[model samples]
Target chain A: MRADGVLGMLDRWGRSALPGATLLFFVLLTLAPLRAPYLSGALPLLPALVVFQFSLATPERLPGPLLLIMGILLDLLLGGPGAPVGVSALGFVLIRAAVVNNRRYLVGVPFLFQWFGFCLLALGFVALVWFFTALWTWTAIDPLPALMQYAVVIVIYPLLAPLLARVRARDPLNVPDASRGTARPGETTS
Target chain B: MAIRDDFEVVASQVRTAVQRFALGLLVIAAFGAMLLGKADTVLVEHARVLALDLASPVLEAIARPVAAANRVIADLKEFASLREENARLREENVRLLAWQTAARRLENENERMRGLANFREGPEASFITARIVGDSVSAYVRGALLNVGRKAGVASGQAVVTGEGLAGRIAEVGENRARVLFVTDVNSRLPVVIERTRERAILAGDNSPQLRLTLLQSVAGVQRGDRIVTSGHGGSFPVGIPVGEVVETGEGSVRVRPFADFSRLEFVRVVDYGVTGLVGSGGPAAPAAPPAGVRVR
Candidate 1:
């Protein structure tokens, strides 16, 4: 086989794993030591941000299964009294749902508009997490953390938006393929 | 070619419909997961342990370079202050040595008195040194991840500390990693005693740098700058471990600045005082909350 063909095979597999890998990166960052006491009020919602970035930019690359899996992964990693299980995953899906539908309009707007859009989506994300936690624990989840997390997400979105823009532009997974043409359970004749 | 274009359009519509359906199902699944988590804690606990076990190695890998970089920075700062620090340390050492002798005599007298009274120990403690791999210094939760875990017999409720003072207790222990709930976590409720007055209070964390001394027997007579130490009320922590000093003493609000610098934490000692059954029965619950009477911060 030609070297290009072998390389192409490797590229395809990498592309297949890219969405999962990207979501995982956000999960890993959640554990980084940022010991600033003031900053502790709101942990950065990196997974939600990543999901929003991708779903807006490349919906086909990020399918529902991967989104759900990444959310579950985040919940499992961060589960305890600190955060309710499945909250982050649900937050990610919520962000994806919001972003994917309005992506076309968001794609052409100025960077600031996009940033604001993300901030809005991130607020909903935090709210989703807060809602789930409140429901499960039978206590009103403290709104301070959720509020702080949203503030941080908004403050840092501009700095991160460019990176997300670059990823959307260059993501191999975003390439049109069978992923976009995926059929439902059974619809051979249309 | 026309047929192919028509097929593409049909496929796109089908894909969109399927994707929306999948999203709906995922929302349900996420809700289901939370419901299951609330209904069945055992499964969540297992998953938490497994996730932490898997995360430990990755956290270690992530911390290596960052730790090295931090050391480089620390070395530079130490070098910058070497002469002044050395002189200060020498004077402090002389003072500490004199106090050490006095402490030994006091310890002897206390042991003799306790022996006469037939006092039983709370829980014998042993410590394991570990690295701070990751920490979430966020608005809601103050958690520190340690590189050492179950392999080192590190368990939840073990007091994590530094040379400076008491940091927090282990909240969750994985196979090779443990998350330390800083004394400043909103959920942290420590049973502490004022060293000078012997007044007992619950040093609770409200997600701040300083812990609030809640459930105080009397806000009165608690002087400013008073030393606070673990009372070992529940036996999870060893008694007399320096927790913090009174930093604020308003009538309604009192706070203690924790001895440990949680923000700059790197390495720590996870001391399991063997309160095994007293509190934290191999679970994430911290020592019982102080009986209700004091106002929360």
Candidate 2:
């Protein structure tokens, strides 16, 4: 009985850690140096997609502090040659806050609707980065790269979203499907 | 039931308030990081280096397979163009043969002149080769992370080059990794002279494919296809290293196409030319001498 209980505890721990681990995986994937032309510019969008999907599907799993840590980790791993240390962290925090607050409207929605919402979020995210980078460097950077990245991210959303949804579905500890009009597992309906 | 409900409501209120406070604090911390990074303080540099060192292993492991796949794809592309490439090479070989003969004659004359003038050769440069583990190529930044660092005698301010020409210089160094600031980065600036006219100018990168030739003393003398080479005016780079070729000359603007291909770089050589004092102050007390059995040419 004790062994079974220990195993169950471990299983719960692993399940609970899944979302954060997936986020970190996406962060590493984004930072991986794939030499394809213009692919590096578009790769940073992968983590942004993961963050958005998680916030919408399971906001409690990915809390504000966890998002902040992942974002800062990304900024650090990108090294000094890219944007300053906190730029990505800032972007991630704002993205989670935005998506979680709007989760009610976003959940249970048609895939296309979620995608449209993501498009807006992505634009705002990219613009925030571009603006912060410009202000940090004190120069009018070329907007073409930012625009190209945004376009690529938008194009790639449909392909990556379903994969993220699959991960969310696999989580045994996941809250009740919000689209089904049920309250989340821990919430009091009153 | 009523007492339990009241306690639950209080707990929920506390949780929400705590979450909001944490979010606000994180937002403030992010802004603080940006400021610290902008200040470019020692603490920030240390953090950046530490982050790079920690990530290098993972980056290298991931890069290997991607590099292999890239090679296979490149080979496939090259195989497709084999016949056309062979034909082009044959034509170029014939043209180059004639130039080779002329160059041989010039070399002989130059040797005699140098002998007569008693020209002394400069110190031979030593270099360490490093494979690129990470490429942070974005619209705003063009930089790379190398797998070699201080342990291998790599240091900041050393000129990095690929087979073609000058790529960039070392910007930061850790125990086992270093960051390269590419020549096409917006922060890159080099003093160069036109090879044809020997006119001096400053080569500046604006985060674009083509670099701009600024501070030209004789703009009228520059034309299409003029080669640009390092002037070594700033003591950061050695003199006479090939930089780029003029691609366009317009009203008050001239563009030079860099010889180094930034997108396709895999390995680079960090050359110690024995010149220092331009970039960061930290380096080996003695110049990095080439290890034994390594050629120093």
Query: Which candidate should be chosen as best, given lDDT against the real structure?
Result: 2
User: Where in model 1 is the C-alpha error above 4 Å?
Assistant: A1-4, A34-43, A134-148, A171-190, B1-15, B72-98, B104-124, B275-297
Clashing pairs in 1: A40-B137, A40-B138, A40-B139, A41-B138, A41-B139, A41-B140, A42-B138, A42-B139, A71-A89
Per-model fnat list: 0.61, 0.59
DockQ of 1: 0.42
Task: Please give the range of 10 consecutive residues that has the lowest summed lDDT in model 1 chain B.
Answer: B288-297
Q: For residues B55-77, could you state the per-residue lDDT of candidate 1 as single tens digits?
A: 76777677777667666766787
Which candidate comes out best when scored by DockQ? 2
What number of clashing residue pairs does each candidate have, in the order they appear? 9, 0
Please give, for residues A1-190, the per-residue lDDT of candidate 2 as tens digits: 1225877788667767877998887787665667666666898777888888888767777877787778877776665453677888888888888887787667767889889999999888888888988886777889998899889889888998988787676554344344344544433211
- How large is the i-RMS for each model, in angstroms? 2.8, 2.0
Q: For each candidate in the order shown, give its overall lDDT on alpha carbons.
A: 0.73, 0.80
